[model samples]
Each structure stands twice: as structure tokens, then as C-alpha cells.
Target: MSSSLHSPWQRHVPQIQRKHQHWLTDTGSLTQKLKNHCEQFVVQRVRQNRAFLNLSETKSLCLPLGRRILQRQVLLICDDSPVVFAHTVTALERAGRDWPFFNQLGNRALGLTLFANPLVCRSDFEYTRICAQDALYQIAQTALHTHHFKVNLPRHIWARRCLFQHVRHQNSRMMVTELMLPEIYQLEKTSKAR
Candidate 1:
């Protein structure tokens, strides 16, 4: 991953609309929120495979290079609309030992599992805004196209990330990053109008 792509992850939430800020700062399960928002909710597993962790991810997980890790990317859809694109990474060794379900979570909301566990402790949120040129922006665009969401693409997208650590196991940690799509804001507007 390019350093520029990870350049703007802020420890504090950026100046954004209150609707977007609510989604970014919420400590609750995003999966549950999506379920509540739409009659149809789906988790689309876009890609899940062994890959080398990026520099920021390696530093967060305290793992060295050459050791492959499990990287899973999924799209959270509500009412047939792609609302969020999530990218998750976990150390392969620690995942198998600590989070055995990491490999088996296909088309299932990882948030449901993580939030349900009392032992899973999440770090503070880090916010960022991604432009069209960013890697995550391209991924979100592709997901929207693949899912056939008929919405206008904005020049930039807002995102947030955090590190989740298992309380009992010190070495077990997973980094999850979520990119909020334009349709999410549209949903908020529609709900408010209703």
C-alpha cells in the first residue's frame, strides 16, 4: 500500500456532515445499524485470501514481513444498496490460535461476531477522507459497480478504522477499515425525509 493512501487517518474525527460523523464515531455494531436501516441486509464477501500486510497494518499487528496474513474484504449492503466496504486484516498465526472463526466467516458480518464477544476490546476510531485517486476509493467504486448501485459517485469518500484486540490474548489483534459510500448519506437523507 502506498504511504499516500494511508496519509490521512486521523486520531480525531474530521470536519464532516453530522450524518457521516454519526456513522464514523458510532461505537456500536455497524451490522446491526444496517439491519435496522433496511429490510434486506447482506454481507458480500468480495475477496478473502492470504496477503502481505501493509506497513501500517504490520506495525499495528507487530508482525514482520514474509509472513502471510489473512486479508478479507467485504461489502455491507442494505436493501440492495452497497453502503460500506470493509477491509480486515489479521495475523495468520494469531488468527488461527485466537480467532478461529476468522477463516470461516463468509458472507457473515464480522461485526456481529466481534461486538458480541465481551472479550473483544476495540480501540478509538481513526478517521480519513479518500479521494478518487486513493486505493480504497477505487475498491469502493468497483464494489458499487459490481453490486449495481445506481448512485452518483462523489469526488471523495469518508472512512474510519480501528484496531480490535482480544482482551485475554495480548497478541491477538485485527485491524478493520470501513469506507463509507455515497449511498449511505443518501439513505440518511431519505430516512430523515420520511
Candidate 2:
């Protein structure tokens, strides 16, 4: 199915519910937040390899379809529950120069590095609700299944993305997108009941 059939991303933050707003709009490191909320937090690297960016990504990064880029996919598990699927893309030429430690992030949370860096600037967030037919939805589900997580796929998954750029390096850009799993909202509900 085409991406047009799915919900398109919106830049408006107010569109999200107030409860989820805190999680979606927070500018702080997501890794740290997850750690605070869960007894165990782990980053499971699903795949890290060179790949071409999708059409939307290509347009966002101003690159062509055939252009090679470093693609990294990981699942952020909190308290043994898979809560988020994160996908990052960076132009191969700029990967090393912009994010020198990118290649070394083995099972390490990228949010910790990006948020800690004083030179890293993040663009306004864009939110979307992805259906089962979306490529990203399949990627996320596959990652979960690969990790032995029970996959009763949801009708739609909420996600957000933003572009990151090195302040001193104009050519260095990285796109990070995260799909929030059902466990995330379940955690929120449990916390509220406490």
C-alpha cells in the first residue's frame, strides 16, 4: 500500500493528546526518560548497514533514491517490553564526519549521544499514525518478532521524526524516526493508576 493511504505527519504538537503530549513533546533525552520509568532499559540493534533512503526520506534529506546512506534500526526495550522502534539514516559521506561515534554505537542508545552533544540541533518534530500496511510498521513488527516479542499487531502505531544537524557542519544531517508501541501507552496507563 502507498504511504498516502496512511496518516501523514503533522508538525502541530497540540494535535496529540495531553497524556501522550508529555512523552511526544519532551525535548529531553528519551533514553533517560525510559530508564527513569522502567527498571530495565536496553537498546536492541536490529540492523546497521548501508542502504538507500526512502522517497520521503530522500526528499527530507535532499538526496536521490540511489544515493547510499547508513541505515540503523533498533528497538528500545523498557522493563523487558519493546516500547519503541527507532530508525536512523545518515548520508554515508557525512556519517563519520558528523557523528564520529556513530559506527561505535553498538547496543548503545543514540539519544544519549545526540542529546548530550552541545552542537547537535534537532528540527521540529513531525508526528504520524502508521497503519499495518506501512513499511515502517512492518519493519517494527519484524524487529519485535525477531526479538521474540509477541506480535499482535495494532491497527495503527503512533510515530514521530525529526532531523538532526551538526551546528558547525552544514552538510551533516541525520534523520531519526521512532514508532511508539502499544506497551508505551500501557505503561502510561499503569503509571497514572499508581
Q: Which ranges of candidate 2 are over 4 A from the true structure?
A: 1-5, 14-16, 188-194
Q: Estimate each model's TM-score.
A: 0.88, 0.91
RMSD of 1: 2.8
List of clashing residue pairs for candidate 1: none
Q: Candidate 2 on 1-194: residue-level lDDT in tens?
A: 12333586788874666777777777777888777777778999999999877766777787887788999999999889998899999999999888999999999999999998999999989888888888878888988998899966788878888999999998789999988888876664235224
Model 1 TM-score, 2 decimals: 0.88
The clash tally of candidate 1 reads: 0
Off by over 4 Å in 1: 1-7, 65-67, 150-152, 188-194
lDDT values for all models: 0.81, 0.84
State residue 49's C-alpha deviation in candidate 2, in Å. Answer: 0.5
Which ten contiguous residues of candidate 2 have the minimum total lDDT?
Answer: 185-194
Q: How accurate is candidate 1 locally (lDDT)?
A: 0.81
For each of the candidates, the C-alpha root-mean-square deviation to the true structure, in angstroms, is: 2.8, 2.9
